[model samples]
Target chain A: MRDVAIVSTAQMTNVRREQRRNEVEMLMPVVQEAVKRSGIPKGDIGFTCSGSCDYLAGQPFAFVSALDAIGAWPPISESHVEMDGAWALYEAWVKIQTGQADSALVYSFGKSSMGDVPDVLNLQLDPYYLSPLGIDSISLAALQARAFLEKTQYTERDLAKVAVRSRKSAKDNPNAQLAGDFDLEKLLAEPYLVSPLRVHDCAPISDGAVAVVLAADDTARNACERPAWITGIDHRIEPHQPGVRDLSESPSTALAGAKAGVASGGIEVAELYAPFTHQELILRDALGLDASTSINPSGGALAANAIMVAGLTRIAEVANRIQWGSIGRGLAHATSGPCLQQNLVCVLEAK
Target chain B: MASGDGGLLSASHIVEYPYRRSTGPVMGRFFAALRDRRFEGVKTARGRVLVPPTEYDPQTGEAADEMVPVGPGGVVTTWAWVSHPRAKHPLNHPFAWALIQLDGADTAMLHAVDTGVESAMQTGMRVTPRWRAQTVGSINDVACFEPEGTS
Candidate 1:
């Protein structure tokens, strides 16, 4: 496989709602900033791939309009995923592996505030059984949380602790939308939005965009001072129905982590995309992260989750830390579908 | 801080995909049984009975062709209370969404157990289906599950 490294990454400050710019307008600066930071001529980048959901935009082919943010007068090899931007990065990396492009651009954006996110996500379920019941995303996560809590030694207090730590971590992240210190008892006293999941335990509805540049070997080395080399990356999926498997465990995350060789080397920092607090626990166990690992310094999805954008942001977060000389090696995780039915793990290292 | 609904120029944009498709044989059998106030599960080659059956086994990818009777009552394997129901939720009042492992079936099915209050819900509670007066061959044919012995 060709050696691909993240050369540059940029993202917008996440907010509860964006009253100013449309999707393209919001993405332009982030994409331009990433392109500029990479020091690569716009025309020279071989391919462009994006991650986003048209459902959020309330229109089909919304990504096509987002393409205007990238300069394509001569046209370029481009593709799109209706998933998180991390998947788009995966596609671009595969293009590099195929020897089709020396460098590729990846981006993802989502304005979750555009619609009622929970109801919108319901459409992703099996139409026959789940969707007809109008099972919202939070309700589904809560169901998993209940199961996880029952089958394990963990309690509701542990879930709250994850919330407290994530929010406190977000204080250092300027791009984070929600960040602050809170009394643990007070947080626990908060009303449950759905049983087993308090409002704080769930990710906030956020609007944001993220962009990253990837280049092979020499191009990667020349374009950036320190390229966060993608040593291993893999994704796995399980049956979508939450009942089919043990909700307390994430087999897909474990499989993806194993396939990506996450345990192959020492990891200093890890950015995980778990929208619900209980899920972070499940993922940490699946990936075998330990006390030495600093998790979610950017507050993770719990801090500023923007649907399609959050997963790719996890990749950029680890890459950004590696590029900044703060961490030597790290792992980034992304999850999609209900209760983490699908998962991807990317391991980055400094060379 | 300021807030106003009419401050920005906007129009209601309703996005919808109003299309209907056939349920195919596997799901069709499940719904057909549901209409008659009965639960039918598909039998996988491994002998595991899957309610709301998938045409194929999730683990082995083998075709599931056999059908078997499941239950009108079940045990709530797991549950999450909905304190304040959303506009699109299955029940308007406070209820619990549960994974019910019906009698005679190996796999659980997701549905609402109308307990009426948060305190009324329990993980291991027994529940029976509340079939609609006039049933259709659809998932909603069962109005919602109710705590066993509820009036």
Candidate 2:
């Protein structure tokens, strides 16, 4: 694959609600910041890819409105994913790998606070069987948590510990919505919102946007002092049925991790988009992370779960770490569907 | 819904979408079962029988065939108390959404549990389906699962 690196990353603060501005308004600043930070003119971006869901906006073709934020006057090459912006970055990286584009601009945005997020996610299910039953996202996740508890030794407290650590980590993240240290024991004591899962186990609803700029070798060198190069990128999807698959583990995630070479070349830090606390535990085991790896240094989804944007934020956090010379090797993960049915993994390295 | 800001004028507007789907035998059967006011579960390749059955075995990716009745009653695997329901939800009033694993089925089905008393609902609670007065070829046919003892 041709060398491509993330030269710059920027995001709007994750908030429970952004009633003042729509998605286009929320995305404009983020796109400008990414281009400005990359030190590249808007014209230099050879391609653009974005991640977003029409369901989140409660309207179809939501990404079409986002084109205004990019100022596609000349009509730049572009594509979009119903997944997350990180997946868009993966597409951009693939375009660069094909030797088609020297640089690419990727972004994602969502206003999940506009409606019931869990209910909207039900649309992602198998329409005939799952949708007819009206099973929303949170309930599906709770079923997974229950299955995990029954099969594994992990407890509700373990899930609470993940939340506590994630929120504490978010304390340093300006874009994070939910942060600050909390007593894990107290969190466990809270009544179950869904048995085996407390309120803290779930990510707070957030509305936000994020953007990242990718450039080839020379372009990257000119754009930033230290660029986070895309070493490996891969994604996979599993069956959609909740009952058919094992909820205790994320096979798709493990498959993506293996294909992305996460285990081959040790990673210094990892950012995983686990919207549910129990999912973080499932992902950690799937990704093969041990104590040495710093997971979610940027607070992760638990700190700022912006639906479509959270996964891209994980990529941005890892890229920023490399841009600042904080870490040499990093792994970033994004998930979609109920109970981690689909996963994307990207490995980054500073060059 | 808001009007698009037409910053750039174009002579023509084009729209495209794809809705091609293969509702395999199982989901086809489930939809057919719904039309008949009956639910079916096919024993998967993995030995777990699922209701509103899946078309393909999740493990082996093979076509699932054995059809069995998932009786009305089941144990709630997990549930969320929905204080504010959405537009497409089965009921407008507050309801407990649950993953209920019916007897004879290894996998669970999601539905609204109608315990008029919200406090009465809990995870692992026993509930039975309250079929709609009129059956439709959709999940809404089962209006909601009511607490076993409640009318």
Candidate 3:
């Protein structure tokens, strides 16, 4: 595959609710920033791809308005994914690999706070079986958390620890909506919002936008001093039915990680987009990351869980670390559907 | 074009769905606050406050527990004139949608503006919320933003 690296990443401050602005208003700045930072004019971007959910905005063709954010009067070649922006980036990377485009831009946005986020997420479940049950996102996650606790040695306290650590790490992130030091014991003391999962164990309803710019080797070298080279990128999907798959193990993520060559040189940092705490642990085991590697230095989805944009933010966070020369090798993972039914893994490096 | 059996079976399916959402406790509180003619934001662990409060903080990824009153007025950070409005937009007439940073809040809130004069709506224009007479538990509770000096 041809060498492609993320040259610029920009995102709106993740918030609980973006009431004053629509998705287009929220995305314009991030898109402008990404292109401006890359030193590439908007017209120069050979391809554009975006990730978003029609359900979140309560409208079909939600992505069409977002095009206004890009000022597509001239009509640039563009496509969109019903998945996360990481998958969009992967598609852009493929476009570069095929020698179709030397540079590409990927973006994602969501207003999860527009309605009941958990209830809205329930729409992602199987329409025939699970949707009829009306099992919302948090309730389903609680089921997974309970199963993980029953199957593994991890405890509720362990889950709280993840919340505490993630919140503390979020202190440095200006765009993070949640962060701070919290007593794990105190968090545990709070009544359970969903039995096995406390309120802290669940991600908050959030609204935000993000954009990333990708360039082939020649463009990458000219744009940034230390481009985060995307060495391998791959994604996989599992059967949508939750009953058929092993919820405890994300076989799809593991498979994608292997396809992306995540274990090739040992990942120094990993950005796993697990909105729930237990999902983080499941992803950790699936990606084969140990305590030695730094996880979620940007506080992760638990910090700023903006649905469609959260997974894309993971790729940007890991790439930022490489761009800043903080890590040598990193793995960025993004997921969609219920119970991690779909996953994308991207291996980034600095050379 | 002809089919093997000398007959063509051509069909097209057009599906339209309207979603009904139940505003849960947090969002319910937010809309309730709006109905009361007050702007509220959820306070995050980092101490930065966001308007139309997020149920969770974007930084810590934790649920926002504290509700803080933000603003009825603030400065317009950035705006774009909506010369052509979409079907579902709050306003059917031509207007400018702006990102207004409400007073006492760290971030901006998006809403439509009724300044009438598109040329006057700049990044730093001061504006105030124009609330709807009939308040529903939705973002449309605030009809739009109007230039502070106009009314």
Across all candidates, what is each one's fraction of true contacts kept?
0.81, 0.37, 0.00
**Which is the leading candidate under DockQ?**
1
Error of 2 at A199 (Å): 2.2
Residue A181, model 1: Cα distance from true site in angstroms: 0.9
Predicted complex 3: DockQ: 0.01
Chain B TM-score (each prediction, in order): 0.92, 0.79, 0.82
Task: Name the candidate, 1 or 3, with the larger DockQ value.
Answer: 1
Model 2 CAPRI rating: acceptable
Q: Per-residue lDDT for A2-113 in model 1, tens only?
A: 8999999999999999988999999999999999999999899999999999999889898899988987778799999999999999999999999999999999999899
Superposed Cα deviation of residue A348, candidate 3 (Å): 0.5
Across A1-351, the per-residue lDDT of candidate 3 in tens digits comes to: 788999999989988888689988999999999999999888999999999988876777878889999988688889999878888898898888899999999999988886667767767774432554344666556556765776789998889999999999999999899999999889999976655567899887789999999999889999999999998888888765443345667888988999889888878889999988999999999989998888998999889989789998999998888988889899888988876778989899998
DockQ of 2: 0.29
Write down the TM-score for model 1.
Answer: 0.98
Better of 2 and 3 by TM-score: 2
Candidate number that wins on TM-score, 1 or 3? 1
DockQ ranking, best first: 1, 2, 3
